[model samples]
Target: MAERVVPEGQRRRRRPTKQGAVLSERLIIDTALRLVTQHGADALSVRRLGTALGADPSSLYRYFRNTDDLLLRLADEFIGLAQEGFTPSGDWRADLRDMGLRIHGVYVENPQVALLAAHRTTGRAHETAAVEKILGILRGAGFPDPTAVRLYHAFVDQALAFAALDAAAQALPTPAREADEEVWLSSYGRLPPDTHPNVAATFPLLAADMRDSGYPFALDLMLEAAEARLRG
Candidate 1:
């Protein structure tokens, strides 16, 4: 089967398997991404990836220097996904909010990758572009150069931090997640008012709140605060 690849300059020739299938860097990364998507974070081992690709595990080294290298590739793809369909409206606040949510969207959709490397730096091409786009958004909004850079730093870190935390929660095994939900519904919701009046009063809303992620609300609060700085 033929695959389309945008060649990285001076990269090695595509490696071929005994079955006559060809593998390129994009193919390897795409296969690994599918493996992570089908299984969870636990499915990213080199052996399993090699098995899925129908190649010897050692052959994967031709594309990636190691498992960490593979992860960087995956993370870069995720960064690219975060900006998919993004267009910068002249309204910077709305634009930034959309960007934040989209970045979080990718992480939530691919919790395994978020859990593995959301907070790690890839320094790969896509990641570099993502950074440049964010900084450009901030600068275009009329912030001073220093403020723009500082804001960009905090903005990205906050987005990734929340994404990672939310992804970890989302990635929990079903049994464990159910157990936590049970605690919320039964244990905490049933707290004795004399011993825990505050929790008792808030339990209903808290339990309801636990049904959905808080990333969107948290993102709003962050953006609101950032906008406040701009107004000052």
Candidate 2:
């Protein structure tokens, strides 16, 4: 029997073709991402996605077991973007800040997706890879494994929390933001000056603060606290 040789192009084509019944998981994930970005996580369903994709709903079952599985994959896709774009330089502060801002950028870019993925845990490959990379970066900066993991989790949690909260605050209707002001004016404005001296004294300064100022200030405070703890 003669040996068989397959051309590079043919081999590549055949490889994909061989995945007969298996759906394009990547395509499905990308479609899911767009759907979540445009509508929201609640807008996603197997049937709806199939209708949007022009495939039978059952066809998605070949790739994902259920909507939860699909959601997990979507989370992976979001984290994967961060991992792909992040480059670790030797400077830990610069590197960590870049990483935090990158996570913020991704969530801010896709608010709906951020809403769904922020608090959920998806023990997927890309998510684990992201975690490992963060740990590696911190450890490379001379932090012990326990310290690195502690800071890594805190950094990630705070970034995502701020991202979600920031999105929600921005998405509030005009009436809602206005209503918040009404409460501030009616309730806090009426506080007895003698009883609440500090509140009255700083009322102007407090009122001067906006959501834009508050979220980043809080996130920076959290980061600073973490650094102090690590230093001690």
Candidate 3:
């Protein structure tokens, strides 16, 4: 690579790929996303990243110091995507429900990114904006400042918690995930009534419903309870 002039005091790294494609921070994140989506989160490594980029692994060091840095950036990007098209209509329940769905939907689509963000707070611009929006909605719906903040915390955490659960289900390899449901159908569903009356009695319902990850049901339950609190 030629001695390219990079701007001073900027952390953005730029270089050319083997196919003469320009690489930047966004390109790196985008490529890393593909790697994670296709091969699972553990597949992300400097050596593997270079192969995907058609450049030496050392080149990635110019941008991300390590894998955590890369994961954080990707998670932040997911936050951006999660809140896309999320507009509050002033009806707190409906509006917040839609926002929750959007958040969970993105997590399902990008399980690897969701895993990275499951425990850590990125404190990035996108995450900050999402918090502000949720708090504003709660306050606008007649919640006192303290109550709004508390409810906002619970609401967002509930969505994220369920998202992480659903994403974990999705992250499982196809055969492994299928086998789980098979256990429910074949083993749990076939338990003898003598020792496991409840399991035998409810086996049909369990087999019919156990296939879902239950994020939607969980989201609605939390939101309904929150609404009841507001009414109370």
RMSD of each: 4.3, 7.5, 3.5
- Per-residue lDDT tens digits for candidate 2, residues 73-151, read 7878778777676778887777777777777767777778878887878988888887887787888877888888888
- Cα lDDT tens digits for candidate 1, 1-232: 1222334564454667655667668877888888887797678887888788788777666667777777888998999998888998888889888988888889988888898878889998989998898888888888899999988888888788889888887789889978977888888977899999999999999899988878778878878888898889
- Where model 1 places Cα greater than 4 Å from the true spot, the runs are 1-20, 39-42
Worst 10 residues of 3 by lDDT: 1-10
lDDT agreement with native, every candidate: 0.82, 0.72, 0.80
Give the candidate number with the greatest lDDT. 1
Looking at model 1, residue 178 earns an lDDT score of 84
Worst 10 residues of 1 by lDDT: 1-10
- Over 41-129, each residue of candidate 3 has an lDDT whose tens digit, in order, gives 77688878888888787777667768877887787788789888877777988888898888888998888767767666878888899
User: Scored by Cα lDDT, where does model 1 land?
Assistant: 0.82
TM-score of model 1 relative to the true fold?
Answer: 0.87
Regions of model 2 farther than 4 Å from truth: 1-23, 177-192, 213-215, 229-232
